[model samples]
Target chain A: MAHEHDPPLDPVFKSSLRELKWIIVIWLVHFVWVLGYCSTYGYLTPETPLITVIGMPSWVFWGVFVPWIAATLVSSWFALTQIEDHALPDASPLPEKSEADEKGGADHE
Target chain B: MNEGSTAALLTFAGYTISVFALAILSNRVGKGKDFVGEYFLGSRSFGVWAFALTFAATNASGGSFTGFPALIYTHGWTLALWIAAYMVMPLVSMALIGKRMNQIARKTNALTIPEVLRARFESPAVGLVATSLLIFFMFFYLLAQFKAGGIILSTLFADEPLFQSAVSFVSQTTVNIPWVNQAEPDYLVCLIIFAAAVIIYVVYGGFRAVVWTDVMQGIVMFVGVILMLGMALWQVGGLDNATRKLEQMIPPEHGSAILSTGTVVATDQTFAKGTWLFDTGKVFRLGELAIIREGQSSTVPVKILKITTPFEVEGLNAKRISGQIPDPGLTVRVTDPKPYKYGAGQTGNYVRNPGPDSGNDVGFLAIGTAISFFIFWPFAATGQPSNMVRLLSFKDTRTLRYSIVTVAIYYSIIYFALIIIFCCARVLMPGMEIAPDQTMPAFAAQLTRDAGIPWLAGLLVAAPFAAVMSSVDSFLLVVSSAVVRDIYQQHVDRQAPEKMIKILSYSVTVIVGVLAVLCVLNPPQYLQDLIVFATGGLAACFLIPMVLSLYWPRMTANATIAAMLGGTGMHLGLTCWGYIADKEFRAYSFLGVNPFIWDLIGSLVIALIVIAVGPKPNRDLVLKFFHDTTSDGS
Candidate 1:
């Protein structure tokens, strides 16, 4: 069952778990805030209008804009973290020598 | 300037600005080696959140906003229950499909969904079948989005044909076609918008860029829908006022009979006499004289119905009680049918019109709201090439999970608000029946006319273009990756230079863009229906094999291949036959019995049977794939 191609797991599983915990906590905080705001301030139908925010209404601000901004921030944070954690490491790995190199350089040359 | 011209100008400008912005962003970010791999698969490192957002963005597409709303308006709110299927999808995807697929994909370095199939089954035929199905279905789905975009454009800029003209001119000039200019300006404009956005992103950034942009666009879409909904509600006074007006427009009696059917009761038994079985306490009383006799007629019900000691009244004492029976249990009186005009001589006649303005269609709204809440939320995550790339791009799973949870909450709110607003629009424009495809845009236009909020209307119109273009760009990246990476470099010439891959990518992007444009030119009457048909087919064909291969040790390669072929073949056969056959044979009901449901069911059944009937796979290999307890401990 063992395969040589199987990737090695870094011993950082614990730290990774810790980092995930922080992310979930922050996300939960924001989620709660959004839910509270939507429940309290959201205009369920068109007839129950709220005051304007930058020519847009309060319902728009709370229901749409607020959640959007929160999601963007969270997503951006995740993206930045991902670039740091995953892509950077893999990109920097030593480029494997091809068959041409083993045969003493390019055959065409 | 006319509303059409203004809207067109805004739409064209918005798309141009966004695309340019995306291009600059991609250029600033270094283009890595393994361009196809890095760009399309994000090197296969996508965590939960980015994966979720990218998935969400892909699923949201043009149909979510325009098509679904139009359906809600047409069918009434009861149809919204169909969306309940969505909530279950994510749980199924994450627990059943996504985690396993991620494992296999990472292990095999499989770039596409089809690649995963190939690796699992070790069958080229399986790969080909899966790839062909993916391409075929995705193309139809993409075309639906294109059509949606076109409809939005036509409605938003009804008068000015400038954007449409530009699209036609560009299509003709680039592809050497003289006849496309004669097509509808809406279709032309949508085609050009999609072509430009997709070509640039796929050509430059590849998959990485597409995924990143999906995350961004997903955020924009979530916000845009919400803002549109809020603005809509504001125009109709407010929620309370809108509800009141809706009540005035549609009486309670006119509400959906199907919903009320759940509340009906037979009035036969003595204990239940005069009382609706569904509403027990109000209609019949056990101790009191509940029924009254008319003239010389016998007093029907003076009974001790069931209040502990059941008994019946006899003789003179059973005489009918006169006058007001205090709180005579609520009688759900079934009213007569009221006929309403629909499309071209079609009349929607309801048997029990609750009242002149009973908002019965609210059931549709409720159902739509529920659908938007769950199933639609997860849809934002499926079959997106750019999203897969983004997930692959992620540095770790932690970031991905965070991104998913955030996007999920964001999606939930935005969709809920949008559905509410559309339901509100139903009340505001009771008799307004623009084309189903143009429902949301027409509503926006009406708001502009009624409320003088051109800016808001313009934004609403632009939203679909943004949503559709984002999806189209992701699809372009996918199609291009398949050609450049999977087919050309990998299969045709393994030693092909990076330059060739880049060239192939760009060339494929352009070609696909052209094809997409051609498809959009001959648009379907219902873009939403087209999208569902395509995505449902994909889900049926891929869902089981992808999941079982990753998770179940018993899923043999033969079973996997069989499931895929069986699912895809049955789906296509049934769908084609349904579409082509005569009316009676057409098993294309909207909810209870439809081609999509049939396809999904067929695929699930065949896939299960194959798994059970076929020989078991190497259990140890399956476990290694699923439960490899290793982490890059760096």
Candidate 2:
């Protein structure tokens, strides 16, 4: 199904995309945990005995502070251990020459 | 000036001189490299510390120092949830786009975001549109930071005799100049000084200067927050004590009032700005200078003074006075007092969600708005072109990976510690609600003075100043590069010589900075609001299009343009609607959510629609950017 002009995908591009997928997943988890927990317990009724944990509102301690620490740990782990390092391609010729080459060659096909 | 003021000024001088030294050294180091590449991109060589700190410092603008602290002092503990998203912001902002953007830029030899987009699509139109939007949004962003710089400097030198003399001289000299004369003399002088310093350093040294300065600024911000945290906790006994006190604290009622003399006074009496006056067992601080002119019954524009607690009154050292006293003959008759819509006379508002707001009935951070900010901090940060520029300059993926972890821990400490320190600020410095933006600097000065080490305030105040300067310099370079490289070299002169490029770059950077200074003569109040609007607008315009172009090979030029223009239009349209409906500058949250949420949604929808209907992109272009053409069509 591949076109004649299309070359194989770059290995670095494939590797980077794979890492991006994991990063997005980690971000989504963090997003849900922060928004879900905070929105659920943030709005408290005046009659509810204002609970305190370590001198902070109990909800904040559990919702934001705890999740924040956890997210930091997860993110650090992912960045340090999970992400792959790859060799970047050398800088190409000036953009004008490349543009002219493309226009003269396969771009018009 | 007192010893504290003198020491603070001297320390500030030393910091400024050191920055110039760095800029000069950076310029000399870049002498042999490609002029444009080295000046704008630092020859694409950034180590972990340089990249991480520059990225972090640029993101931590005036809003972090002035606007954010103001919100914390006013709204209390609710700010925790508001800013909690920063915990993952480093990973989200950097890791998501860093490697891909770097690869793309290197592949295209692109020096700017617009340049990268242009090269990706092979269309000059895309570059032009991107350039236009970048300049437009960045100008507003520059105005906000310039205003913050002026405010910080003004606050730092509030008691200095030299600064007072300069303010007075400028006021007298510019009394007849229509535009310049309208601003407060102190603020105007400070704005000019701040603008000049930033412009000179950036124009001379360029990108390397910005990165080097950012490294130092980042360290100052981190150390400053830690010191303040320790001192604040010690001053307030502990976080628990501060929280308990905050629970019982009442929000002040602020509004303009008419101060009348009970009798026509025999002598002309003048009350300086920030003077504390007491009447009817209540305490108030004059927001501006009040002069009872000879033989006049009242002063016409006696700016606002809020009704604060007697506990604060004792600390304020307020004189025993009444509204209708014959001896001094000063009558404090309040008019048009505007009380808070929520928690006006209540306790326990500070430590709770939907905290008390001076005007908003929905309170400061409604649940919907809270959800919006959690998304805003990371995703919006990712959208910033300034951050994108830093992404392009890091040495390699290892540097990227390590810096991500470093910034994650750095922001965690800075943002969380700021909340704790400013919450304690309410206990130590009352009546700050009158001028909330000055809370950080004022608190720094007061905290150190109380500790009998007033000179330390300079280093603490420098944290915010450094933040503003780092952002301003980066933004100046961005706007300059847009004009020089994106617009000029791409369109006007592809073969332009290097010497001409250097002259234009410097000239454009200085011109833009000066214009920004002039624009902020009467700066917007609540600097955080302006910061949010500009930053949100930029994210709305650029985030989706840039992401798609980097990853999705099928994306066409038309689709990218649609996303940028449509996103910006939605954001501006909503902001205008909000202003017309509310008679204020804030964005109209159509469904109790921040306008940023809707803007992103709308941008994505528009981009998807365009991509669906538009012609397919060039397959050859995809081959170039997304595949290994170097390996020959295998």
Name the best candidate (by TM-score). Answer: 2
- Model 1 C-alpha RMSD vs. true structure (Å) is 16.7
Candidate 2 lDDT over B505-596, as tens digits, reads 99999889988988899775755567777888999999989888888877888888899998999999998998899887777989778788
Pairs that clash in candidate 2 = none
Q: Stretches of candidate 1 above 4 Å error?
A: A1-109, B2-11, B44-52, B84-95, B161-182, B248-393, B448-451, B524-529, B580-601, B608-620, B627-634
DockQ of each two-chain model: 0.06, 0.54
Q: For each candidate, what TM-score against the reference?
A: 0.65, 0.94
Interface RMSD of 2: 3.1
